[model samples]
Target chain A: MITTDLVPPRKGSTMQFGIFSVSDITRDPTTDHTPSEAERIKAAVAIATKAEEVGLDVFAIGEHHNPPFFSSAPTTLLAYIAAQTKNLVLSTATTLITTNDPVRIAEEYAMLQHLAGGRMDLMLGRGNTAPVYPWFGQDIRQSLPLGLENYNLLHRLWREDVVDWEGKFRTPLQGFTSTPRPLDDVPPFVWHGSIRTPEIAEQAAYYGDGFFANHIFWPKEHFMRLIRFYRQRYAHYGHGTEDQAIVGLGGQAFIAKNSQDAYTQFRPYFNEAPVYGHGPRLEDFAEQTPLSVGSPQEVIDKTLTFREHFGDYQRQLWLIDHAGLPLGTVLDQLELLGGEVVPVLRKEMAARRKAGVPDAPTHASRVKDKYGDAEPRQPRPNANRGDNVTGGSPYQDTDEGVRASLPEL
Target chain B: MSDTAPGPAPVRRELRLAVVSAGASDPSSTRMLADRTVAAAGRLAAAEGITLRVDVVELRELAQEITTAMTSQFLGEGLNAAVETLRTADGIVASTPVYKAGPSGLFSAFFQILDNDLLIAKPVVLAATAGTARHALVVDEQMRPVFAYLRTMTMPTSLFASTEDWTDPALSKRIERAARELVLQMDSGFERRVREESWGSYQHSFGSAGGTETGIELDSDLMRLAAGGQA
Candidate 1:
């Protein structure tokens, strides 16, 4: 836990600025044109690459099981995006912790982490879709339990080489080892993303994970109290000072060189988009929440207030590219975002941030924090044994006698 | 009479009565029924030496905000203020127009946004206004169960005033009877005591994101299963 007064303890991740997509395949209401699923998926790739090209810090996508959203397999998509980019840290707006088995999640994301060369992290969320619960062999009534139980199991699987877990939502595992292991013996950082669930905030604080407020839709007052609660709880659990509790926030903005053009261009998309279209007028929503539709200076003025309200947050992500504004327009947005908004924000947030506030987290910083100039652990296997399905440690690094239970079986 | 006459002046305890009127028009019969019920309740509470303060939440005025609440999944400033009024009340007088075999859409919409446990154990006087006497049963059948779902103590003497009943002397008596029941519950302090002694037992929407607090105990065998040893 070494640190400088000015810089965060970790390097290259003082605070992150990025974009998150709902991965909406929306028809452009103004133009009356829609992108095919293939085109939209390709556009998502283009958007992420453009993010890195323009010098943004992170590129996160959402996972949805139903239509009108095309990002069902986020690990695969992020893995693909990871191969194409160099330093842009890719992540998820959320990976569903409720439906998918925790074992599969641990294995899949760990594989992606290794492939990405420690350039990944993810957020966990209980999906909002009710019908989708049953589609994944789950009951919506048990969603709260599913989320908590699954996340607990996932947390243990990464840190412990041999996991003995028993939970209600999934089958009991006596001795299981998730394959590939986390990159350099470090799990990708996790942020618990929630809108208003205090229990989710409590959960994040309990485990000392980051708590992310999806601040785009609701008023800032709602989230301010919630973040305050999380910070207090984090201190209660002995994580750090209330100021040291890692926090990330979501925002929505559409900026142009001129403020009027930004407003005019984003209005139709706001009027017909599925998540919040046709509900409140743009001006009212912007006034109430963190949404800013104006010049980069306007976005800067509004985003600076976030620190004043919530106190030195670790990350700020914008929801910029849903509602089918088309690829060309979205790319132009990334340009303004990287070229204008983020530079000022990084400097201002650093100036506003006090000492001992942890960085948003990256794989390298986490590995450094865990090992600290010590050689990182890369777990080895005794043999290519099929015994991991049965019991005992498949990993050589564990004290559970690697492949000893296997030879007898 | 003005306080100089009395040896020691009596302290007036304020009883908040939330009045929800789901009328769409300015001079609406539904609003008229709600106001009449409030007037009766206020008079009865005053007779028993309690001051009644009625807070009106007109559903017509909140149609757009309700739609915004539906999409955004949180109440705006105006709508949150309205809900906060309902939460602090000792009793409620809910009146709605009968529309196509049930309560009007606006009436149901407003209630839908309230946290289910918000009105728990509070007494309510259910009233409805309609064009024909046939829709009189809508009060007991529709509105009663709606309040029942929130675990409110909905009064047995629900008032349903059709166009004819407005002038018929019978409906006025029914309104008084309903109001008397509400006032009696308030005087007994059933909601007040529960809210005071065991307010933590009442769940909230923010305990989880928009999850129901329908007075149904959420902790179960699943807690052990979900969090394992941690639970």
Candidate 2:
């Protein structure tokens, strides 16, 4: 009989550990009244750079279109961060495919890929607000269709040499190519983000793309069901076994030496969070949602439990900055996560994923192998030109006035 | 009033076309595509006997200022003014190149920083140029939905040209045709506006109190639910 004790310890899992900061220029309730937007933006860059310094694998910045929130362009910020740091993969917490045209999205990201040396990826979503549609001259009724069509176009834009597409929402294209080719000639891996929509999950599965469940607010069971659906669909698509399908998850947590301290420190910030405030009790949220509140060990244990539900997946992104938490507190949380929680979690996950575990998506993995080694083909010698194409002399003049140039012939 | 000075007639209905190029260089493919689209609009306006004011805004030059404006209250005023012009324009031709697998973050950032109500019901023509024949679908995949979400009346014909297409005369003709079709649609909308104006007095007499004919009622709950699901 199979014994429960025989289950291996989770350790050595190569996870793409990331920290996301939603930069909003707000007042520091403690001492400083308010900070300038530039300061907030600068702080975001600092935080991302710090995350890398602290050994985090990835750093994602969010996109927002309103006042107070400073980061409207996550990739732009990522590019700047890319210039400042090395080794850390840059990603977007959210990219609104519904409101932005696919063409511009393609060009900008390709540019970013060149800027970042192919260390970029994105999570596409229909943004969170309705007011944004009219602001962009769009109708919300077409959200799903838009997402579907836009992603379809984006996929073709990346993988193919030419694309011919016609759709209901946007104009038709005959043959188009996005420029500033990606570094290493490999497109960035995409993680389709969703909370409740099984449609997005199915989309991810159908395309063999990674499905990311940003479980910030919901219970594990809800995320499990969605992930299960994606896994099953992924198998149905003939990509691999259910466990082999790539999955990424988003988590939020605050930790202190003790549970009580964690709650006390995080409560004030939780209460004022623009997205999650006034909804649930802090303790209850900790219990029901993915918001782990306690010591580093507890955070590790909670994260390890994710494999039990979703199996060995690809990435895990955490929200360290939310609810206008002060920079000091936020940094403290990151230090705890990076120094303590992540090390243990990495060990545990690696041990658990001992066999039949799919590797996390990477730039090296995505590049076409044949193209990887081939030197760039040089242009053929010009037949029309008797000498140089620029009208320069074809050969060096010899000292002999007897036309020594013909000596070799 | 002097007998020689006739009373000022009602101002002629002027059509404003804002052509925003989200490309880098002045003669970049996106800009070229945008120019062709604006030229089409001008032709339609001339044909319709209406004065068309074309404003070509290159996003590259304004990208940094717009990002700065998104945060600073004072700088935001300038961005808002530009946004206001986009809102009031009769038509817009938005062009960009596909970068990665989606729209450029620069373009996306511009969209991300704009207020959602700015582009409601305005007509938009989407166009993109890329390096290879690939990424032709980015117009539909990345951009159209964004326009749709903004509640803009997007023209159905998007013009996507690759590097080869840019160099080919046949592709240029195709782009011109697509631009002409978009202009035709905008001109038709203009005609509808004129027809509506002729009957406006009688329609206005019967106020909303007499009928339950409310304007578009958006389902915020559904949108929220969708957002949650997508997020």
Candidate 3:
């Protein structure tokens, strides 16, 4: 039996470690077999379940409208994973803020938060796929404004009872109350994930949200500058000190019992992976990027260096299941991660992490933050005002004297 | 408008001259032409008592890396170094051998893959080398528009050297004229002035210039929208 005894117990609040999948349906080059969509979907569910089984803390999935990626409906998949696991925090590697309607995001994720008992969060990204914009009636050139406006609306949808919103990207909302108000009336925490965009970082800092850097595929110098900017801006916006800012990072690693065995095993996958395939040599990629393909100790050593570059971060999500690695290989990879890599990383990180650094944001901590010792607000819709539009005070506890305004007609 | 602070006096001690030559062979004529143009430009700058430090980005050496960057978005060491050199360059000499009556594909691909905002308002001298004078218009007709799209100031004189022109005085005359225009543009400090005065007006993304354009303008419309204000 693979025991998780080495896993660091959650001590009030500490760093959270997990795996994030882009839900890619790549062909396994070793076996020359491609998993069908149905098979890949099942594999994704298994991966999330296995992540929780091995004492991992979070499971985040990506959003893609294109083929070769199975996760178009992240909440549906995450909600299902939520039902299967007890302690895992379900999230999205990124939800397309540029393309998806924020109303749907507010409603769906709020509902997922409720279903998962507030064990959920989301990372917003302006997706790289340009064609996805027009399919959703958006222009890619305006993605920055579209993302900022959508998040602005989504932020208020969870906080305000009834929102009257007018923005450039979307139609106006008059007395609109997004239903199934967030679990315990506390919205799921948000983390903005960006590879290079500072406006996204600025957006994250402006709202005091977490900033997640997808730390794979590129050198650390590029990410270091952006992360530094985010931290300073977070402090500038009065969220907290730079060190207290919540930061998450994404990485890719392949580990084994020995360094040579790990490299030999992963060479085919590295050379054939979709993103960097037929491009850089495996050894060069391993040397230049955050990709760690070596023994568990080696992987752990490389991962520990992240804190040195980015400073004490909160969440670290790895991309272990992509590049057409079989389900068995992925499970073994997770076992190594949970049984050896993360456990050691946890202790080392905990020892080195400075005092006053915040842990990854969670629903329980956020709700406690909101309520303190008092009872949390339970929003109850007021009596129907005879139309689809909500009253000025949609909920009973909005205010004593607030009322709806009718047209002069 | 009133918030603009004249921060520090612009530094103009040494001008960076980046020469991007797309010749494939060793001691290629394209590079020779580029070298001649650079030498002429250097002489003009020395006459003005300005130091011109040159950085040559031989695209032939970076051919594989450029293709890799285009395909995988992974910039190798050489390509990144070249980008950095070009990013800091005050003036540029772009010399490409005419391939099938056009600029070399490798040369065009290098600039095509760079961030659109990287070369904004920078001065460039366009030169092309071909086997015949029939392809002389290639620099004006083909390349000027590409540099135009990048918002670079292509010098008024375009340099083209055919097999015979290399031995002719007219080629020397064109190079001298192009070099003069380049030195004048660089000495004018046009790029530094525009970037210092109006960097925000140009369309830019974070990490555009090899991750150097990280300035956050808080007063932008997008930043306003980020702060929950109307766009």
Best by TM-score: 3
lDDT for every model?
Answer: 0.82, 0.69, 0.88
Off by over 4 Å in 2: A1-13, A29-32, A368-409, B1-231
- Winning model by DockQ: 3
| Per-chain TM-score, chain A, candidate 2 | 0.86
DockQ, per model, reads 0.30, 0.01, 0.56
Best by lDDT: 3
Docking class for candidate 3: medium
Model 3: share of real contacts kept: 0.75
Model 1: per-residue lDDT, tens digit, B1-231?
001111122437778888888998987999899888878887787777777777888888888999888766647777877877888778888989999979998898888877777788888989899999999789888888888888888888988888899899898899889989998998899987876787666555563312223222325544333323353
Clashing residue pairs for model 1: none
List model 3 lDDT by residue over A1-409, tens digit each. 2223464556335899999999999999999999999999999999999988888898999999999899999999999999998999999989998899999999999999999988889999989898888999999999888899899999999887777778888988766778889999998899999987777888899899999999898889989988998999899999999999999999999999999999899999988999799998788788888898898888988998899999999999999999999999999999998888888888888889999998788998998889998888898877876765446877888875555343332
lDDT score, candidate 1, position A183: 91
Ranking of all predicted structures according to lDDT, beginning with the best and ending with the worst: 3, 1, 2
* Chain A only: TM-score per candidate: 0.94, 0.86, 0.96
Between the candidate structures 1 and 3, which one is better when assessed by DockQ?
3
lDDT by residue (A227-249, candidate 1, tens digit) is: 98789878988989999999999
Candidate 3 CA-lDDT value: 0.88
| Chain B structural similarity (TM-score) per candidate | 0.84, 0.71, 0.89
